[model samples]
Target: MTPIRPLPSYLVQRFHGWRATTYQENRAWYRRLAESGQHPRAMVISCCDSRVHVTSIFGADEGEFFIHRNIANLVPPYNPDGGYHGTSAAVEYAVTSLGVAHIVVLGHSSCGGVKGCHDMCRGLAPELDEKTSFVGRWMDILRPGFQKVAHLPDGEILRALEMQAVLTSLENLLTFPFVRTAVEADRLTLHGLWSDTGEGLLETYDPARGLFHPV
Candidate 1:
């Protein structure tokens, strides 16, 4: 293979700027974190949306959260077929190795992934229906979620589907044996959240009410 190229100038400049500011100001904290390794309390499984900033949302510092991002923040039902499961691997690492006490499924409004699922379910996205489409196969995890909102109006289906993704992930998470065992032993808790990107609003799922409430 050819030698790897250097990072883009803009990204390199940004790194330097951050190092000169944030890193310099918190040099001791950074060193301590590096030495001690991460002992994070929570694992946040969020979407691959750039607008959803997990750190800024919770005012979290470095090493505070073990984050795993994927399309629509989905967690597939447990299956040990020796297949490559990136999201499942992250969850296992976060729960089993990191010993995170909480697992948060963070879904956001106007998410392209969720919209894609809505479109695919309704036959509007034939490209995503192809067997060779990685995104299509990955998004099949949300097919059960889309079923709940399939009958809704066009104006409501997308948002409903977004919320469903969070709930679906929360449900699928328990399908993992370790996750279920930890939760049963009172060592782990699962949470579902939906954020309105434009309004900077967050709503959490209330299991008792089976609904989302403003947080």
Candidate 2:
């Protein structure tokens, strides 16, 4: 990758000026939040997409939701020796350490990571082969989904892949001993959400209906 220059000295000066005003308001909120520490009601697993702001969609503020984000918002099945377990670590802290009651796996339309996985599966991006980069290994969790829906129409495949990823993550969540215990004891609930970027709608899993219903 080509190196990019840092902000011009003047931009840094302007940033400090703007940050001072915002930081003051942030400080007031933090002071109150620090009093009781975080007692979030839910832990959200979402994609690292700038367009999909989970808090804004859910009408939540700080301390209300524990959020974990990553490429394609993946949750690998619990592996004791998983090399880089950033997402799983967050789950451990959120479910065990923080004792969050609900966990939502938020998948979205037109996910870049999902698209990349599809490309890899179709042999469109052989450069990202299993032996090469971390992303290749990281995205392997979606391999089953891709294989299952690869032959379908593009639109159906995309939707199916999104939902499949959410279901897969939910299965992964249960692999964690703490999460499994809490769930079995009725202490935790797992939900899968599909956010439509084009329609700007939130669809939640409906166990009774076995479908994603609008929220």
Cα distance off (Å), candidate 1, residue 155: 0.9
Best by lDDT: 1
- Residues 63-96, candidate 2: write the lDDT tens digits: 9999999988889988889477888899999988
Name the TM-score of candidate 1: 0.97
- What are the Cα lDDT values of the candidates? 0.95, 0.87
Q: What TM-scores do the predictions have?
A: 0.97, 0.87
Clashes of each: 0, 0
Query: Which candidate has the top score in TM-score?
Result: 1
In candidate 2, where is summed lDDT lowest over 10 consecutive residues?
Answer: 18-27
Name the regions of candidate 2 deviating beyond 4 angstroms: 1-28
RMSD (Å) of each candidate, 1 decimal: 1.3, 2.9
| Per-residue lDDT of model 1, residues 38-94, tens digit only | 999999999999999999999999999999999999999999999999999999999
